[model samples]
Target: MNDLEELRDALHTPPGFTPRALDLDAVMTAGGRLRRRRRLATGAGAALAVAALLVGGGQMVGGGAVPDRPGDAPAAARPEVSTPGRPADMLGDPVPTGLPAGTGEYVLYGRTIDDDALPDTTFGMMLAVRGPAGDLTDRVIANEVVGPDTAPGFHAVQGANGPGEPTFGYYVGPATRITAKYSGRTVTAKQARWSADARVIFFWFAPTDGQLKMLTAYDADGKKLPAGHNVVGVG
Candidate 1:
């Protein structure tokens, strides 16, 4: 053995020192406790990181952070677009049960409520959103008024008041494919189920992509559909 190994052996097996019997059970129990502690610490740290992400800025969406203020930085950290998929259950004060529309990174919950006696605003469509972090923000968008037969087509509904906030809206039609144009580039809008009715759908464009110059809806057959009476933007 080398010098270091020889020194370790001498210290471990010193003469005239009778070592206690090995306690395999005790050693295992201590190891288990240590492992449990490590697991708890790891879990706490993960929770803290998620909490910080939510508290630091209220605009994170689509699996990335959104800058709190404009000119801070463009939202390049976010995905190019949220892939359309089944909406996952989001954590909220009163977890929204309405038909949510979004990908894994973000979800949009909307419901048309009509109850004057309700504590919260109980009129028009109540729209709430949740970011990738899995908690719904306090912000909610509600239309003051909506008529019974009002079928507003694709329209610009800004989710929040800043420059880089998301602009989304609902559509009631037979469109299965929706596309929006910005800066002469056409981008497919991410869509999700808004209701049992296939015609009712929710869609949105990426943040900080600038206002959509035009939006077009297409049927499953790829044929362009005529804009509804309440179409928003250039049809």
Candidate 2:
């Protein structure tokens, strides 16, 4: 589904089993009963893992290298093979792609959100900019204040009526309603996962599509922060 749906779903689903220990007999019985499933799952997972490796190395699923799908092919969870910023000694799954490449004032990249917000909303993208464009058509996208730009609150994403432009409704301070719009095709939680770093500014949100999302964040020198101020990281 689209990012909004994914986000909504994540908001509804409650956590399942908590951390616990397994006994030998319990483990043995569970293993025996789940042997076939476990084996099939393992084999399937292995194949997918191999496929991911190949894809990461600039290879495609069927054969030759798969052309980048606007930006959605990588799953935003970091390429399985090799990539910069990916922590070394990372266990099974890769460390997820760090952000996009940019210079001048700021940089933008995609990041994965925690599972709590939205299970399917696994990723978030950010566009870092330093300055504003002369007109709305310019690179920088503007997200109006739902009420305000305050953080640390739950503000459901809404009013992303326009397809190419997505707006964010955030809880500024307390009851303030604020909306931020990014200039790009309709993006979903998965496809729109990007991040910005070092003197960069970013804004993103989801609309109605029921599918995936594809967004691009801009990097501008004017969008950069002060000499020492830290730029917030978003994906």
Candidate 3:
């Protein structure tokens, strides 16, 4: 009791000291402001790091180290052929029926086949007509056949029907003989004409009449080809 009473007297307030109440609301507001500032600084640092990563990724893409995919390969080139022999406007005009001016009763018909695997390339222009005996007749005008390597172009069997008929053209290849059976008669390739570009051979032929049957192409060895090997037929 004596010691506690002495300590209390020593701790007594000095003269003119005033006691004041604490402001709890002001202290809480100041603490909240400090926490918000810390959170803002953390968010800004994270945003800057993400922006740097994106810029680095863009630079890597522009470095050209990426390999080309299969889809990015270039397309194959197309075959080259000569311009059409006849005028475009003269295609469907009717032929005169008589005299020196009259060629024949014919109409223009064109057929083209291009196959790289089979190595068969042909572009033919046929003058077709209905015969007096109710048969279909086809006369060759311009025929172009591409060869394998240094071989000559394709040739056609010449016919006996005069100038307007299909004639034989020239070609060089393993093929030695070409025969066509039409109207109960067999026609064979005769003469050959070299192309202006020298890449192909042209063959003219006489008019083929009656129900057209088949065209058989042969190598120099005279072997009958399989059903569709270099064989041309009416479809």
Candidate 4:
């Protein structure tokens, strides 16, 4: 058909079906159930775990040098396997291809709300640490969920890891920049897309000692946004 005629025909075409309104509460509940089932299958007790650990190295606690720059820590030792370890399946049913972010010592597994088939409105990310040889228990360090808000903000968690591990968390909304001060140094966190939507960003930084201070998030226009409360461990 000619371009003008095709355009006219398209405009007259009937939608194949009626659009149905989504039941947000019901959908959210279903998503929660699915998540709980997955966690049970993995034998993971809580989505978040808090403990002290060295920022770099295979061990979770004590005696590892912190990288001077964020994302520069040495790779954590991977468990030897004749084949890849079974997928944790934490992110989604068919987990995102590139996941488990971080150097080997600690990895972050996550699924953006949209990534879930049922889309858990309260789901965010899980921070995990490697365990002893052949120990498959999920060593979740933090589980931070932002709910279904579009406000540019982040939820941060801190643990008593000796020498301090990286302050980790997830940001939801339209923040393009995230930074914080820890132990008198200004640290900038590395950001990555955690969702198909541009609004969700997962971030972390080089390990720093002491309490995290003035953690801040900024939007594209350079306006500082609200920094959500720093919950002890996970929120």
Candidate 5:
């Protein structure tokens, strides 16, 4: 017999037998619910993958945790520049003549000779009398007797003022004697001593209108050495 004929024969129930109909609407509703659940699960998996990818990309690009706000970034460090007096005004006015032509006026701190005896601090202003190329001296001449309150004496020996050479001069002091020639004339003064091997001559003399009295180099027997330049400091 054919399959359909057999199923019909089997369906032919015995006496007093009955069969119930299937709920087609309920089955269709259960199938729809299963499909909706599958779609929701798939969407949730895709969302989680996308979130993981975004976090990984952020880590790769930023090297670490990302900054949450604009102000979260670290500030850049800066270098410190040391200047005397006002921080705003580091350089001073340019010296007119004595300094090298290109050099300008700036504050100079005095070096401590003996740390045990004196405080390791700036004694006074070392006026940087810079000049044109090859015209300025580099060594600093300081006075032990006078402190920074008194202006240091600066003298440039006329003929001997050369590069890498010792220029003899004097720092104004007590009981120190000075006698020399200037502008083809001899000028004598007491309380001064020879300050050899020094560029800046530290002296305790109050310059008038930024001018020091001109003098020449003298010897022990009152003999004049070479001609020299007398440069003083102002405010």
Candidate 6:
């Protein structure tokens, strides 16, 4: 009905059209060939159009056609003070996970490593929580480090313990502990120990991927605690 549509239909028509009364196979073959040719032309035209758009788009973006307003204009679209030492996040959130079979029996909280860093936290932190009576494995990721749940504290940042203060992993909401350490002579990561309310279990490893040593608390009662034994005790 529209002029543009009518023009398109007219242009597609064969110039020397005829209503033949013979040679059925010949007519069919010719018609099929014409259809194929038309289809090829259409596909080539579409490809050319897409190529043109891509080139034009690259130019528009690269040429700096977009205005640069100082107030809100973006130069380039590129896409945490927890405590003095630990991360600090005040907003409340509940972490979720699918892990060891015993998961979901207890609730989880905190951020996943793949997620954008939570407020006042590291970019690649795996924070979590386990409900009461929940097994640690199914409750937490296979290799994630976790500390015992403690009462909420000011800002959710990892605690700042130093050589002078020698802080242990306790206070909660969000905090970081020396969950891992290098034990080899080279001082590379060979062992680690996450904190709990009970005795610490240090899993010593080797250059190879195998469990070499698992040191349990030698002085649970602190009877022979080395002068500055930084035992892993939690609240």
Model 3 quality (TM-score) = 0.28
Give the poorly placed runs of model 5, Cα more than 4 Å off.
1-176, 179-202, 206-210, 233-235
Against the correct fold, how does model 5 do in TM-score? 0.21
The weakest ten consecutive residues by lDDT in model 2 span 134-143
Q: How much lDDT does each candidate structure score?
A: 0.42, 0.27, 0.35, 0.46, 0.29, 0.25
* Residue range 10-103, candidate 4, lDDT tens digits: 9889878787889765555444433332231122122221111111112321222222232422233222321134333345321121223233
Top model number, lDDT: 4
**Candidate maximizing TM-score:** 4
Q: Write the per-residue lDDT of candidate 6 for residues 127-178, one digit (tens) a residue.
A: 2223344422111111112222222321112211111111112122222222
TM-score of every model versus the real structure: 0.43, 0.18, 0.28, 0.47, 0.21, 0.14
**Candidate with better TM-score, 1 vs 4:** 4
Lowest summed lDDT over 10 consecutive residues: which window, candidate 3? 33-42
Clash pairs detected, candidate 1: none
Model 1 is weakest, by summed lDDT over 10 consecutive residues, at 33-42
Tens-place lDDT digits, model 1, residues 1-235:
6799888888888679587898865554433322221121123332332334334312221122222222422222222222133323221222233333363233455433323222232222223344555544322332212233235355323332334344455566777888767678887767765553455566765664456656788889998865543233210
Residue 113 lDDT, candidate 1, scale 0-100: 31
Tens digits of lDDT, candidate 3, 94-128? 23222121332443333332222113334333334
The order of the candidates by lDDT, greatest first, is 4, 1, 3, 5, 2, 6
lDDT of 1: 0.42
TM-score ranking, high to low: 4, 1, 3, 5, 2, 6
Question: What is candidate 1's CA lDDT for residue 69?
Answer: 27
Q: What are the C-alpha RMSDs, in order, of all predicted structures?
A: 24.5, 21.0, 38.7, 19.2, 41.1, 28.8
